[model samples]
Target: MTGKTVVITGASSGIGRQAATELADRGARIAVVGRHRARAEAVAAEVGGVAFIADFDRLDDVRTLADDLLFACDRIDVLANNAGGLVPTRTLTVDGHERTFQSNHLAPFLLTQLLLPRLIESGARVISTASVANRWARLRLDDLNWAQRPWLGGWGAYGTSKLETILFTEELARRTAGTGVSAYSFHPGFVATSFGHGSPLMALIALMSGGRYGISVEAGAVPLIELASTLDPGFPSGTYFDTLTGNGRRHRLAGDADLAAALWQRSAELVGCVPAR
Candidate 1:
């Protein structure tokens, strides 16, 4: 990764933070993006890179972040759309979208779309942090905001958002075909991070896994590091990686080609960007 420029969201902590450190050690220029200014700058200094602050809850912040990156880096070889959290309730963002759905999917979708041109030019890899919980998504394209069916604790909402991310990856890779850009998604293996706070679903997982509940933060970051650092992992663009499943396996419901296309167009409309197709 020497001489490569990598931009990682949610780098202030958890899997993203570990990847930023490891990638920086490998001689890449790190653009540490986080919601918190102090933590972002601290991580940037720790990695000898620059810090960018953007609240994923706001679309404007994401747009401004893209502009900042375009001006700060000559090329972006890797974009880790790893910034997200479990909202624990059916809440709304300032943008009037479901908080979990927006933060975990729409915001990153906007960021990726904004950077698509630069990524294609640099032959970059776009990596999204998805989850095994995607199986429980029960995704409804018409109910992306969960207004029709409510999951008050945010677990189901998180699942749907994750499913959306994988679908987004599929459409993204298809659109960027032959454009020298690749998109990958992966499950980070239930890392015991600051995420999922106050969610009963996560609590149940802890009980089910017993003593082996969650992996260490560093352990969870391995797959992300693999995809971001190199073009390896042996999976084609839009493929998803999960350690428990065969390589490139994703959720059963996450393979809808038509849905992926609809999602791309809908997301483009939501974020006010022209779909690259």
Candidate 2:
């Protein structure tokens, strides 16, 4: 990782933080991105990397972040779309998208598209944080904001958003094929981290587990760290890793190429960007 440039969102805490620290230790130059200025700056300083702040809930912030990153890095070897969580209730962003869908899927989708040229030129790897809850998703691209569906305390929306993440990653791989820019999504497993803030069930699990639920934050981050490094074992691009391996259970809809393509187009339309063919 020596001399490589990696941009990690949500680097202020949890899996993103652990991954950033480990990558920096491996000699990669890190871009620590977070919603909190203090925490982001602290983590950046600790990891010997730069900090970029943006709230994914706002599209304007995402735009600014993209511009800042474009001006800051000459080459981006890795872009970690790891900033997001399950919202406990239905909420809309300033841009009029569902909170979870916007933060977890739309925001990263826009940022990645904006950075596409640089990423393609740098041959960067795009690694995203997803979850096994995607198996529970019954996504309707037309109802992405859940306006027509019952919110059901928002877990369903979160799952739908993750399903969107995996679809986006796969479609991204297909569009950018042979460009040397790989894309991947992974479930970090159930880890004890600050990521439980938005979901009640997750909060209960975290409290009960006392940081021993399934794995430590550091252990949960291994897949990301490993994939972002030059030492990566070379898993196929667009592979949705269950934890550390490419083989994992997924909803039948996840592999629907047409749906993935349609979702990509719809996402691009929603974010006001041209869809990649």
Candidate 1 stretches greater than 4 Å from native: 201-212, 244-249, 275-277
- List, residue by residue over 1-277, the lDDT tens digit for candidate 2: 8899999999999999999999999999999999999999999999999999999999999999999999999999999999999788888999998899999999999999999999999999999999998999989977999999887778898888899999999999999999989999999998767664767787677678774677888889988888788445557789899887785788889878899999999899998878455
Best by lDDT: 2
Off by over 4 Å in 2: 206-212, 230-232, 275-277
Tally clashing residue pairs in candidate 1: 0
Q: Which has the greatest TM-score? A: 2
What TM-score would each prediction reach against the true structure?
0.94, 0.95
**Candidate 1 — worst ten consecutive residues by lDDT sum?**
243-252
Candidate 2, pairs of clashing residues: none
TM-score of 1: 0.94
